[model samples]
Target: MISQVRSELTRYLRTETVGGAILLIAAATALLWVNSPWGDSYFTMTETVLPIAPLHLDLTLADWTKDGLLAIFFFVAGLELKRELVVGELADPKRAALPIIAALGGVATPALIAFVVGFGTDGMDRGWAIPVATDIAFALAVLAMTGSRIPASARVFLLSLAVVDDLVAIVLIAVLFTSAVSLLWLLAAAACFGGWALAQHRRISSPVIYVPLALIAWYALHEAGIHPTLAGVGLGLLTRVRPDEREDQAPATRLEHLIQPISAGLCVPLFALFASGVPLDGKVFGQLFTDRLSLAIILGLLLGKTIGIFGISWLAIRLGIAERPADLGHRDMFALSVLGAIGFTVSLLVAELALADVGDGSAVELAKAAVLVTSMAASLIGSALLLRRGRVHRARHEARALQPEE
Candidate 1:
């Protein structure tokens, strides 16, 4: 059973690697479409509204991608978090402390840098959360391409840190961005969550029964003025992580197995398509360096994230609050920290939420462009560092293998 589970995880990681490449393609396509002669049509398609009058669910194509499809991604994320907290690497209090501490640093430093950079700038301060995210798919893909000699522990560390980063981003979205709340609908959403938990406790395995309940919870949360993607997190946490003695796999594991491909392939790519379509003309490029918002995002992601994650991690290890993995060195940790700055997916979502109420979308456009450019820059820098490190590790391993026998 353990081997089988490992096999599944390996497959999932491979799929995510491919999915990351596809996501880049999708984002590039969106950018091209938006900047092409037919750019207005791209806007028109995204803005076309579809409304379910009875449920008060009205959304555009872009909204569906963000609020609807991205829920699948968050649900998968929540499942991963639950597994880690319950029986995975993070199951141990000591093992979890390092990544948790580093993730907090990762979140705080970027927000502080962004706030300081955008403090006096108009409408830029709202996007303080923009650099606090790390695109797991893209980062992992870059790591995988860095070569096979990279320590497995490095990947594990990166995954744990990214999960915590996502958790922080979710909280920011729920608390910092929400403008209003409706108690009645919020209560309804909570009730739905209760029912979902009850069903999980009862060992209800049928998707038919749970699907409608999930939709109801989503709708209620939407009406409650909370980001409905959070409904996915709530349901996922409530999933059963431990199987009954008679069963081989837990419900959460099974659900993750079923949903991960969908989330990676369809939902995330679709979200990237809609969310990354910034019209990058000459004016946007000219303002990329001069604009406070762009500078904040660039510095926060490129400089602040690297410094924060690595600095806090080093502090934690030095103080004996956390232990570095035996297989990983300071350089490896620093490379992973650089990868943490590739904050594409959630950062773009936060930029949209932050600038939603602003009349003109110039600030929004600038933020989106910054996220794209900075993420790419981080990826390149991280990949270079990891590649060099991988070669050194590989050479050391080969040298050890060639040592004289006793």
Candidate 2:
């Protein structure tokens, strides 16, 4: 019975729609829980501190989910990124140019818009980074549900763009969030990376060894004042993706298969539960539109993402710098841009880091609310557009099928 339940859960977790559906449910539960009459309990649960005295670690429930569970999600992201760089869509310069360019355009325009709007605002410095990330799981979920008649290359394009966006977000976290560094601890983290790479090179696959090593690396990065999540990315990239002559799968593939279900079904959803519990009062709603910080985030996501992604993609294709996916039209690309605007996971993480030092936690809360609002709006708009475009493609396919094979 237990194995049957486990098998069912694994199947569910492997589905694109299921992961995103669970994430949305988690976020909604958090929102409702924080606003209910028992709201104090929600706050209490998230704020309660847990300390590991030996390791000098003291963190709240929210922090643990963000710092620990979210790291696993990033680890899966890192593995996908490494796979792409080594053997997937991003392996060739000619094939890679379109998504890479779109990703850059996506990042730059949102940042520029946010900075321009919130130039003199207190959290502007960090808040500008929030809308630059595209939540891969969420975007892919919408695609799978609404774009069944679309070409497979559309999914490839979206995944590649999101992966590059993840890389940019990682760099930003490492560069912007670390205010001070302990060199000795940093060196310890580096040593951990060395050991991880060595393990990969030697084909050592013991969980006992790698698990503790990963924990130590995370701790070292935390002590070094770096965002400890980068440890997951580092270790994931170092894992071998190519299979040996006698092997069915490489270490990266095995780890990803083991870890991704846990990440999608548990880790990411838990982080959303903890991190997305912001209070949604009338004052917050007013601030979302009137306040520069929230306004910047919303506009950056809605406008910056749409114009940047679609515009750059069109130009690249027209100039012959990049090839367009066969049978997809300008309308489909526009829909993709709108979908790309749904920046949920990494955007929320950025909101926390960016406004962590801002006054009274209000800025952080507002930034998060803006992300949520923008993501919802993008999802709705993009889904509608995709559904309409899908019908057109479906009609074309049906018409072609009805005609005699010629």
Candidate 3:
């Protein structure tokens, strides 16, 4: 029995979705622990002072995870964006149209809904971008809970949609979220991108060589009124090697593979732990059912996300622009569409941006609480529906197989 149980545990661990599940669990655990009676200690530990060189950087341990560790997360996101543009789904326009179109609708609808909900409010309007994100880790966790039930195309569709979602989220952060604009520094960043492009064109093989220049670019953008992280995307986009005529490519794919493990294993999880820490105490629970930003976020994810994703997807299929996977029908798509709102990671990132210049942490905390609640609810409902749908699909298939004559 012990050997059998160990073997089963090993099999579960080997599953692709299991890692995502573990990450979500870790995030939830961190949130719970940080909000408990030991919460003050948790806060202190995260906020403890640490110095690097002459500059002393002090942040709650959470801030380090958010600002410091999340750089690596964005770096990996940059890598993924590069890969998708080069050789993955985003490479070909024809194949990419469906998800891209659906993603646009998905992103736009949520933002619009958020704005509509917060219309009369002053500062709350800035948080329009909060609900427009889809957390890939949580979404993947939803998919993985299905075991073998989810079709390959559905999985691909979800991933492709998320790629486009991430793209839009990046643009929103760079454009709408930033306060001031610095033309001179922006020009310098542009020049750095141009240089990186030239190196990629010339088959430059040194990642080390780009480090200082990238940092310079980062500083330029940071000073230029753009978020420093946008530079990561810009640098990634500029330096990424396209899979064209060259026989031996430079550092693109190799760098991507090397970074994926770090991103998935450490950076992302740490980000999750930091980002997910919304103190869910008595006051927070009260706000969950009443606060405008919280209500907007919750309703946007619960109602708008499903409508946005499924509504656009239905239109696409109706217009013959795209079709669902063979193993997936409208019912299955609805099930999957519900999961689209599990916007934990991306929502938190956007929340950070939305609440950047606002009142200290209140808006961020409200957004986090909403995201946490709605995303958890979406994941649970979506998972249950998909599992049942999968079982029904299997039963119908088996019944047809057993039929002697039609």
Candidate 4:
């Protein structure tokens, strides 16, 4: 059972690593498209509005990428979270406490830092949530590249931390960023979720039944003024985690296997393509440096994330509230904490949401640029640290292997 779980995790990591590479390429393409001669076309394409008046749905291409495509990504995330909680590392209370505590610390510290840095600055304080996110795919890609020699326990810990971080980000999006609430639509969404739970309880396995229900729930949430992507999480959590006696596979696991590829390969990269394209002009460049919002974001991600994650994790171990994995040393933990600083996908989403009503597009553009710059720097610095740690770990392994038999 343990080996099977490990194999599944390895497979998932490999898929995410490849997806991260594609995401980077997509982001680069967006940057290039925005800076090229056809820059106006890129903006035009994303800003083009499409409406389905009958359904009362009206959104731009960029909005669809964020609200529609990213739901697939969050659905996979919810599956992983449920798996961890139900049968994986987080199933054990003692084992779960570390990453859960670490995740909370990670979120709180960055948010606090952003708030402090942007305090009293116009339109800047709203972006406190931006630095609180950790991009799992991108961070995992860095780990795959630099820390392959590290133990599987490190990967497990990182995955757990990232999952919890995403959950917090989702809550922040639902609560802090929501503009208004329509109680009727909210109740309708609740009914859809209840129906979803009922279907799962009855072991109804037909997509024909569930898919439309999911769409209705998503639409209801959109109408309720909450981020509709949350419907994905709701449906995913309602999925059955225990294997049927006959099939020996949980519904959550099965659905994850089917949908993960779509989320990682298509939805995420598409979202990045639309989200990362910011027009670069001299004015934007100047704003990137001078703007309080940008500076708060950069510092919050680069410095605050590392400090918060590492500090809280250390405190947890020191206080006997959590125990570090035996295979991971203090050095490895610190290195992983540094990697946690890579806040790209969700951070970009938060920046857009937080600053949407604040100013002209320039502030949003600057915020996006800050996220790009900080995430890149975090990737480089964290990768270098992990590479150094990996080499040390490999050397230790080799020395032990070379030792004479007892």
The digit string of per-residue lDDT tens for model 1 on 137-191 reads: 8888888888457888787788889988999999999998777899999999999
Residue-level lDDT of model 3, residues 109-221, one tens digit each, is 88888888876654566688888888776787678767356666677677778878888988888777777788998899888888777877777768776776777777677
Residues 1-406 of candidate 2: C-alpha lDDT, one tens digit per residue = 2343234323432454567878899999999999899889999999999989888789998999989998898888888888778767787788899999999999999999999999999978778999999998788888878887787778878888999989999999999899999999999999989998888888888988799889989999999999999998998888887788888777877887788878887888899999889899999999999999999999999999999999999999999999887677999999999999999999999999999889999999999999999999999999999999999999998999899976
Task: Kindly report which residue pairs in candidate 4 clash with one another.
Answer: none
Poorest 10 consecutive residues by lDDT, candidate 3: 4-13
lDDT of 4 by residue, 37-74 (tens): 99999999999999889997889999999999888899
Give lDDT for model 2. Answer: 0.88
RMSD of each: 1.5, 4.2, 5.9, 1.2
Give the Å shift of residue 305 in candidate 2: 1.0
Give the number of the best model, judged by TM-score: 4
Residue 358 lDDT in model 2?
Answer: 94
Estimate the TM-score of every prediction: 0.97, 0.96, 0.87, 0.97
TM-score: the better of candidates 1 and 4: 4
Better of 2 and 3 by TM-score: 2
Q: What global local distance difference test value does model 3 have?
A: 0.74
Order of quality (lDDT)? 4, 1, 2, 3
